[model samples]
Target: MEYCDGGSVVDLMEKRGFSTLRIGEAVAIILQVLEGLTYTHNAEIPNVRLADGSFAKGRGLIHRDLKPGNIFLANVGGKQVAKIGDYGLAKAFDQAGLSGQTMTGNVVGTPYFMPRQQVVNYKYTQPDVDVWAAAACLYVMITGYSPRNLQDQDPFLAVLQNDAVPVRDRTSAIPQPLATVIDRALIDNPDIYYKSAAEFKQALFNSIS
Candidate 1:
């Protein structure tokens, strides 16, 4: 994983364009994370595959504990990339439909990027939660700041619940199409969120053209 090293998305944003690689290379790394998560969410069973597939495909639920310290950042030529790390909270979804009722565990995900349903509702699904986190992470990488509501315990949850502020509101400079893409991704609705990592990537690519 160190070979694919780059600091946390936060660090990368602070020093964007500082990498030794070109922008295309940086985009490739971001796409890498997309492809990796896509496989885990769509095909691999919970706890099956690592974000980068170091271990065997897993079963059960994957909490995906994301944090600043856990993630790494390094200079990739002239590009900086965000690498997923630390699977301490990564667990197998062993239960049947999460105890035949709730779709996920009560204690899951980081405050800044987790959806509200995960925190407030017991029936949230893993795919939706991951989508929200992915969008949030992308936001941090692009803006160089975590979309946290310091006033609340979990700002990401706040965003999910209210559905009032779009990602664009937080950063006015964001292009309309890109902002819309992220807005749909971060919301609490799985139906609207990209069905798979590939779909999400395509939408991003489509928006540019």
Candidate 2:
């Protein structure tokens, strides 16, 4: 693993008391993350073995844990670059044969960043989970607060009840166009949410244009 001299985004936020970053800086970091996800979601690795001892030629991976803590910043080519890390919870699934729930019976990922479908059905296989989590990260970057501050409540119940306040409601300074994109990503209905990281990135870019 390459050394990240700048450390994780969570560390920076904690040290700086979660101060909001400049809009350009925030968007840049988000775009880097989205770019990384785009590769991970589309890359095809060969000769992969599954837990069932089955062999497969190619598969796309889902980074189940995608909070700020799992994202690191490093100075590369004289510029700070955000990179996804901590793949301990990553899962590989067949993108071509995406079938019914492949995971269940246990909760995964950070509560504040998890999507509604992930909480209700852990086995659900869809790239939207990461999209939603990335949106939560964006919310933190802009407002310095989690989309839902459910620290005191049961995370499962909080997500089930859809207790998060809309990003627009939390801060009026956010541009309405950007706020709309973030709000759409936070939607519980997977069908209505950003379908892929590339799609989400495009919407984000459009907001700042």
Which has the greatest lDDT? 2
Which regions of candidate 2 are displaced past 4 Å? Answer: 95-104, 149-151, 190-192
Kindly give the stretch of ten consecutive residues in candidate 2 with the minimal lDDT sum: 95-104
Residue-wise C-alpha lDDT for candidate 1, range 33-113, written one tens digit per residue: 666566555444533333343445444444455544444665667765556676655444432333322234465557776
User: Which residue pairs show backbone clashes in model 2?
Assistant: 103-123
Model 1 worst lDDT window (10 residues): 94-103
Per-residue CA lDDT of model 2 for 1-209, tens digit only, reads 89999898878777777688766788899899999998997778675555465667765677877998898999999999999998766666563332222333667778888888777766545677888889899898888878876766787788777555787787888888989898888887544388799999999999999
TM-score of 1: 0.66
> C-alpha displacement of 162 in model 2, angstroms?
1.5
Give the TM-score of each candidate. Answer: 0.66, 0.89
RMSD of each: 6.6, 3.1
